[model samples]
Target: MHAAEGLITGLCALACVTPARAGNAVQAMPVDAFLDTLAVNTHVNYTDGAYANVRNVGDDLAWLGIRYVRDASPGSGAAPLSSYVYLAQRGVKFNFLMHENITQSIEEVTRLNTAVPGSVAAVEGFNEINNWPVSYHGLTGIAAGLAAQREVYTRIHDTQGFAGVPVYDLTGFEPKQVESRVNSADYANQHVYPQNGEQPTYEANGDTWMGNAINGLKKYQLPLVITEFGYFSSPQAGWYMLGVDEPTQAKGVLNGYMDAAAAGVKRTYVYELLDEKPDPQNKNDGMHYGLFRNDNSPKLVAYAIRNLTTILNTSTVQRTRVAATGALTYTLSGMPVSANSLLLRKKDGRFVLVLWNETRIWDRAKGTPLSSPPAEVEVDFGTTASRVDLYDPNVSEAPIASHRDVRKISVSVPDHPLLLEVTPGAPPRL
Candidate 1:
């Protein structure tokens, strides 16, 4: 049974609603705090091109999540500790995973704290203990896996150097099976991938499949962290197919981040930073799950994420009200008539309105990008603004000017997200 069954039943008890009309009466939440919950998963070796790719995406990542020790063998003399030190020197904080032998994992954590005191943000006991090889205890059953994690959790906390550092429970792949065992550590950690090929939409009360998994863990009342969540671009033989083209991957990622934040997750990490090498014999060997391609070039989704983090992370934001009528209601050419928006007041007193159409942009049956003519969207800023700038996430150029001294402005909205900046009085310094 799916973990969302309980959440679905609870929501049904409240009301039954359709997708387009689901969040019509919902109130907006603080975007700045939501952005603070964003993080990207990365494997940086410093020697390989991983470091450069991480540096590029680091501005948006809250912190890095890497293996407690390097992925290389102990005899490889790769010096993974030095790489951790390098990241610290470059101002990159991290949450290290302990999936190796218990003694070595403890020694590594001790060494890490000694090298850069208070550098490690959180230490996870193990990873995906329900699955073999990845599970340090090599236990297949949930009960045994929890017991092994409990031991590691106790050992890590009892170690001399890791007193104040928070230790997270092992991240299980299935939420329902491990929800009861999450209380063994300081915080609850889980990995959720909503790869059913549906757009991440929420109910009147913010809820999605991912949100339901989070809600399932709410019984423990522990701080939650989604250690890894993302979609792949190609399908592997044994794994379920959640692959989409680059653009859809970008949209799914952005939607996933927003949904997780709305669910009140403390932190979220996208699967990876760069695409790994695909198997030569099988093209779709499930290795291409990175924001950047294997050659170290940025994908469309990379720019989308960068644009989102840039706009949302730069300023502190508080939720505000916007009258949704002429300017805010948007419709697609032959698609759904719905507008998704977030209204935020920046710390500098300027207002930012983010808007996007809810129409599907990808045809799963045909496996191609869906196109629609831009819909015009207008919004009343409540007061005459000195300047208004419109930014398209698909493009990386400067924003276009909309209008001056007008309280209301209408602009064409695309399937992708657009950022609108409205200054209340004279244009503030950019």
Candidate 2:
């Protein structure tokens, strides 16, 4: 990776332990209501409930990124040309779905360009085309999907004056699909999950994330934009941590993005800003992967994501908690890091550290996994920095070590780490 393009996220490590005073002041307020809190930050982008929530939540967010869909339904359906016009006029980017009518879809895209001129960010031709019977049915296969994506991208780029209109090929399938899509699409769109439904908690997906990312570099070497990634494992299981339930399925969705960022994939827009509604088509609660609840309240994962965005924008590496000497020891330097200065704790309670390397090599000899239902570890840090703790702010004010003991931390070095926290009066003093 280029020095500039090298992953800055890998090097920097964040101390999850924050002094009580450095607690997220916005925790008490509803996330939806705290939209103003992110306005000044450069990382957290906002979008009103695009496909679902009717409110223009973007107004309060920092960046007003929007997903414009020309398709009418969640599953496969006709391309809604009117939807493009509506979104284009609103100055939002359109996430184009590759539909049955490629030519008609192209025509609508042209009209959108003419309508909004240069307002669209990029166009996403299809979504998860690698899934069964969609675009990789063996009849069409991955090649056909690639051709379709390239065709759409070429047409848009070759337009009268829109030669550079970027195209995003979005997919969130396994490593096989990621390889296929990168070989074809103009950009990489990945979905993430810490583990398959079988695994316990947020354990890294191992070389799965790394393999796909390296594939992207080998094939197109194109820019990456993670279209849909969250904590959902599958359509059934979801992501959950501590006492807060975030369905393992949801965690699967998030793990993809986490994996992507660690692998140095850029420009990730978390799956859906709001929870998905009944599939106006299949009607089976099509993936409850919303950052916020139906009523616009934030989920535990949402806060995790919100803080993650903060960490990504400001800090570099995401620290996972591990237990050693009956104390909390964060696996800070094991995984890949792209930051310059790795910090443990600095002034103002912010776990802001510089990254030194793009890809981190682990010393497995130093770490050991705790037994199941793991033992607790106390993480000590000063209480003077401004830190954004990555957890469900709604969690109780219990002691750090006490809270950490309730669950087991995954010890898969360079793969996964449990992100924990320390409240005020809980800092480890020298």
Cα TM-score of candidate 2: 0.50
Which structure among the candidates has the greatest lDDT?
A: 1
Instruction: Give the poorly placed runs of model 1, Cα more than 4 Å off.
Output: 1-35, 45-79, 133-140, 156-164, 177-183, 202-208, 235-240, 278-282, 312-339, 343-347, 372-378, 411-414, 425-430
* Top-scoring candidate (TM-score): 1
lDDT of each: 0.56, 0.37
Q: What global local distance difference test value does model 1 have?
A: 0.56
Indicate the worst ten consecutive residues by lDDT in candidate 1: 1-10
**Residues 156-229, candidate 2, lDDT per residue (tens digit)?**
67767566666777443344444454335677654432222322112232233333334544454666655443
TM-score of each: 0.71, 0.50
